[model samples]
Target: MMAGMKFLSGKRSIFKVMGLICKKCALAIMVLALIAPFIATTQIILGDSKSDLEDAKKQQEDVQSKLEETKKYIEDLQGQVSDIQSYISSLDSQMETISSSLYELDLQVQDLEATIKTTEEELAKAEEDAKVQYEQMKLRIKFMYEHNDETYLGMLLNAEDMADLLSKAEYINQLSKYDREMLEKYKATIDYIAQTKADLEADKEELVNMQTNLQDQMSALSLLQSTKMTQLTNLNNTVAAEESYYSRLEAENEALEATTRQLEARIKAEEAAKSSVTSYDGGKFKWPTTSTRITSDYGDTDGRSAPHKGIDIGAVKVGVAGDPIYAAYDGKVVISTYSASAGNYIMIYHGDGLYTRYLHCSSLLVSVGDYVTKGQKIGLMGTTGNSTGVHLHFDVRLNGSYVSPWNYLSK
Candidate 1:
């Protein structure tokens, strides 16, 4: 009976040991199940953290690249501006030279005019003197003809002596010689006066031609100066726009870097806490304007010298101003201000690195940091800045690079 009790006690002890072992195994299994999930969650969080870090790093690189590119472009614009200024200065110098030449030419023309007037007076006097001398010569010739050779012969025959006849012949010969000499002298004077008048006229014609040429040159210079001035104005406007854009880009880069740092820190915290992450679904966006007709299509180079970066929506009455502009999606207003190139513009930041820009507005209805919903009125469309007509210039950006707005807008 004692041996039987010992056997039963030993069996009970074995059963207790098995039960303890089973309980330990179950506890280990439960712990393992919990630990496995924790490990998986940790892995997922780490993966998200890594991804966010990579995205931040990539964004930083992109910002740096854009900054470098903008700096280079600004330098290039500066050089162009300097060159244009120098060219304008050169043009000014040339105009000064032309002015000097024109002044001298005017003086020469005045002198020539004075000379011609004096010559004309001299010619008129010479003609009057010639006419009077001719009339006197003709009267003398008529007297000599009426007297004739018979009177000279009679005088010679009736002479008291040979000396008297010789004297009479000498008197007639002297009178005829005097009359011929006077007529020849008058004819020579008239010819000389005519030659002088012709020479003066020729000189005057040359001076007039020179004056006309100088005037033409002045006109050409004036036209060229006008063209250069216009070019300079355009260049100045472009520089102003580029400078504004550069400043905005710098601010954006700084903001992006700050956001990236914050994201990195947040990702680290999330990894430690194994927090949930939010994602964007990339939903379709609403049309930004009431008018559906596109005045300028995306990538169309019709009116633009380069590829158009965005689409332009015309007003309801076709080139009329003051149409309402709407937000394409729910977003926060990131920028709202006026620009020389974009006029009264607004930029919105939707989550997940998406952005939209509205340009050439006559008035703004929103401010920066204001939250806006899809189809909300944000501005009024009109021809401002670099626009030719009343329209809305709409743009979409993925990160900082421009993309087609059509990709996000509803058809």
Candidate 2:
């Protein structure tokens, strides 16, 4: 009985030890399985972090390049503003001088009117005197014709002696000479009066024409003044209230200059960043349409003489409304919209303050933030906005402002 009890106790101890060893082995296997997954996850996390760093660096470089370009644009705009201001100042000076000249012309016209009136009166008096003299001369001519033969015959028959006959002949010659002289004097007076009247009438007609011309000139001057006043008002409004337009212009210029300086500073900072990073170069650009006759050049003034900032190409050859429109440059789609004024429109950011716009599109093939390469199909053409017919309203912009699209594209 004692041997049996010892055997049973030994067997139980061995079984317990075996179970403990098996439990340890299973725990070791479980730990290894769990640790393997963690190792794989760590590797994946490291790879993702590296990729994110690379992406961030690339984005930073792009931002830097854009900042540099924006600075250059701001500088150019500031210079243009300065030049416009100088031209406007010169125009104002010219306007003042023109106003003074016009005032003097008005006084001259008034004086001419008075002279014309006096000349008219003088001409009327001269015409009446000429009529009276003409009538007196006609009566004398009739009387001489009626009595001259009778007198000559009677004088010849009544001659008593040679001396008397000679005296009568001298008297007849004197009378005839006197009549002839009087007739010539009267004709000369009438001719002089007619000439004077004709000259006065011409002078009066010229004065009337001068008055009409003066009135026309005044109307033109008034229009010019009104236009100038409107332009001045606009300039003043744009510059705000500075008491003097010149002073206001100077102040606005100063502000623009300061902004330009700040932009330059930012550009320099971006340049430094770009130097350390690999830049993501933009893709090649493609033609926006197949049609290529430019009906109007960019920045051309229309019939109203309104300045046109975009180029107008002939769209008659191209298919309307559903004609594929391609991207002109590599850019990210920034805006896609439809409005009553712009119709279906799309804006693409070509980086560095350079943007392109497609207007009057019948259809849009892109959304905002879609990165596109040059020559990629984008939209279609249609009649939209302030358009007479179906045409693509294409435009190029530098730093959020419109510029001549022709400058960037070939015919």
Cα deviation at 59, candidate 2, in Å, is 3.1
Clashes of 1: 0
* Candidate 2 per-residue lDDT over residues 1-411, each given as its tens digit: 332343354345435534543454465356446434532332110112224344434434433443444344434434434544554454455446545665765676576567657666665665666567656767766876898778677887799988999999898788667766765665675566567656656765675665565455445445544544454454344333212323433443444344344334334433433343233354434558767656666777777466766666557564455667888977677566564566787777666666678877878899755677778898877777666667777777665467777566643
lDDT of 1 at 263: 51
Which candidate number would show the highest TM-score if scored against the true structure?
1
Q: Any runs in candidate 2 off by more than 4 Å, and if so which? A: 1-57, 149-411
- lDDT of candidate 1 over 1-411, digit per residue (tens): 332353355345435534543554465356445434432332111113346567656655655665676566657656755765775676577668767877887788788778878878877887787788778878877866898877778878988898988998898789778878877887787788778778877887887787676666567556655655665676567557657756755665675566556456544443332222132368898898888889888899985688888899889898788889999888777667665568788877776767788999999999766778889999999888878899999988675567888899994
After superposition, the stretches of candidate 1 with alpha carbons farther than 4 Å from their true spots are 1-49, 150-164, 271-411
Estimated TM-score per prediction? 0.52, 0.32
Tell me how candidate 2 scores on lDDT: 0.57
Q: List the residue pairs that clash in candidate 2.
A: none
